[model samples]
Target: MRRTPADVWLALPQPFLASEALAAGRTYDQLRAACHRGDLTKLAPALYAVHREWADLTPAEAHRALCRAAVSSLDQVALSHLSAAVFLGLPHPAGRLGKVSLTALRSTRTSYPDDWRRVLQADMPESHLTSHDGMQVTEGSRTVVDCFRQLRLRHALAIADAAAGRGLTTPVALQAMRQFQAGWPGVLSAERGIPLVDGLRESWLESASVAVAHELGYPLPASQVWIHAPDGELVGRVDVLWFEWGVVGEADGMAKYLGAYDDDPSPTAAGQRVLLERNRERRLEGLGFAVARWGAADLRGGGDGLARHVQEARRRARPEQIRCLWRQDLKDPLQEWVWPPPTRA
Candidate 1:
């Protein structure tokens, strides 16, 4: 009943310590040989994962794996900041994952590798800690606030919006959390950004779109607004809506359209979806709503690109031309799609 390296790797929890394998009757030489043979991939010092699992992961997943490995190796460390955001599944600005973030009480002297970034604080509130998939993580509200304090305004708002939209926290709660950290270095920035968090946003792109709109000084638009045709049929739900301005803003992601029809992946299918989207835009135009669409490019362009799109929408808007209903008389079409969807007690 001698287990092979693959069997040992499969049997142990992922991102495990070398000592665990040794304890299970696996020799140190065997572990070294497995790593040398590509059966086990060294994540950090002493932490290993099956080579196949490590190689097949997306960048985000790989980053999480590193975070998990870091958590497993460190003692009295609770994941915080961007690392906590990742664990909580909140959206964050793109950044390198070369370092893992952890928080510990100022009194605790915990040594970690150079790759670990430790944030020591005098107050280690119990309420702010929670267990996520067996790892200690800073709670969502605290994580969002920490992000707002640590990241740039745009980056922080993206995280806040994602957290709120996903029902992890609310603007009010985040604001209240900031009250205690008044003398903190980045409190003002967090205060200014908290009001921008909107829970209705369904995707990170939509949140980024809103952040860009805010940078352009545009008024906050209703999110997830329903648009109806003259015949009372649902046209679609717009990402951002400005009723008085007669403009509808869509944060377009190509992935949303592709594979939408019959799960097709060919170029022809993609072209067909594009044509259908164009026709849908035409219908919106006919109803007197100025349609403003921005894709990943505009998002990558930063605030300037978003401002340009908003200016175009403003130019095209004709409030007098609007004939479509903003709200439906029937039950909310997207009630079920709401985040933290209703649960039976």
Candidate 2:
């Protein structure tokens, strides 16, 4: 039995290729009719997608679709910058970013870059190249440092911390790349943001929040510290610990507590998660630490938004009451976990 356009459209992937559709039993006339009827949107020469589904995607998702198109269109090109970050699974700030990005040993078209793609001209070493699925891509550390040089401080730190946190790369390697690429466009921003990365941060939200804290000139806090009761009972592992100030800053994402409440996103599940958090806060406060939580709204507020919430906790915390119950495995941030060979690594 032959498949019709409707059948093939649903069967094919989002942002699929003209050839993919034709291969999947769509005739040339049907592909054109679909395009004419607004059933498909052309992303590039041969790349296309279901129009309605494409419209519903967020910026990041849309970019991933574009990256996939680039993967299909180019032959032997290394995906670079944010496009490389996408394939590497590194987190980036939310927003519409520019064209699909790639790297070539040298530019193929001397006249112009493709309307939808940015091809970086470079002679990057083989060591700095890797692959995603089958498409050539810059390696993790190289991708990250590339982004750091291209993006601003807030966006760069999030990517850097995520790369470090996941064991994909180390701050030391990032710094070395910055020095090697010195005087290249935007290298100074990379150099500045590289020092602020802490691999212990578990999420992009936590990393970005700390980046803002740096700009606000707030005291830098310890990342991922464990607090124990004097009796040796583990109270909790915290996101950010101002050890001396007795402050515990928690970066609460929208879904942090939802999954544990049975993956049920109902109001009841939300309430249960809040109850559990409240209970945890009471216990941490019992240990003389004032616990504060910040969310995306706080980060979005800008100015003194997240800062106010954490600083308020600081006001309530008693440094004199701070105790040795919190056991921090990494006392020094610059121990540079991935560089020094983790005792366990």
C-alpha lDDT of residue 260 in model 1: 45
Decoy 1 TM-score against native: 0.82
Candidate 2 pairs with clashing backbones: none
Write model 1 residue lDDT over 1-345, tens digit each, in one string. 333648768787676777777777788777778888888988766778898877787666767877776776656778888888887787765645546678874447555565445545535588888899988888878888888888866667777877786778876778778886788877787887787787777676787788767766777777887778766777777788765577789888767677743568788988887898898889888877789988757866556666778779889878675766545224744221122223321
Estimate the Cα RMSD of every predicted model relative to the unseen true structure.
Answer: 6.2, 5.5
In angstroms, what RMSD does candidate 1 have relative to the true structure? Answer: 6.2
Q: Provide the clashing-pair count of each candidate structure.
A: 0, 0
lDDT of each: 0.74, 0.76
CA-RMSD of model 2: 5.5
Q: For model 1, what is the alpha-carbon lDDT of residue 203?
A: 70
Residues 77-185, model 2: lDDT tens digits: 7788988887677887788877888887554642156678887775588888876777778887888888888876667778888888788888778877887787788
Which regions of candidate 1 deviate over 4 angstroms?
Answer: 1-4, 94-96, 105-107, 110-113, 117-122, 229-233, 260-272, 328-345
Local error of candidate 2 at 149, Å?
Answer: 1.3
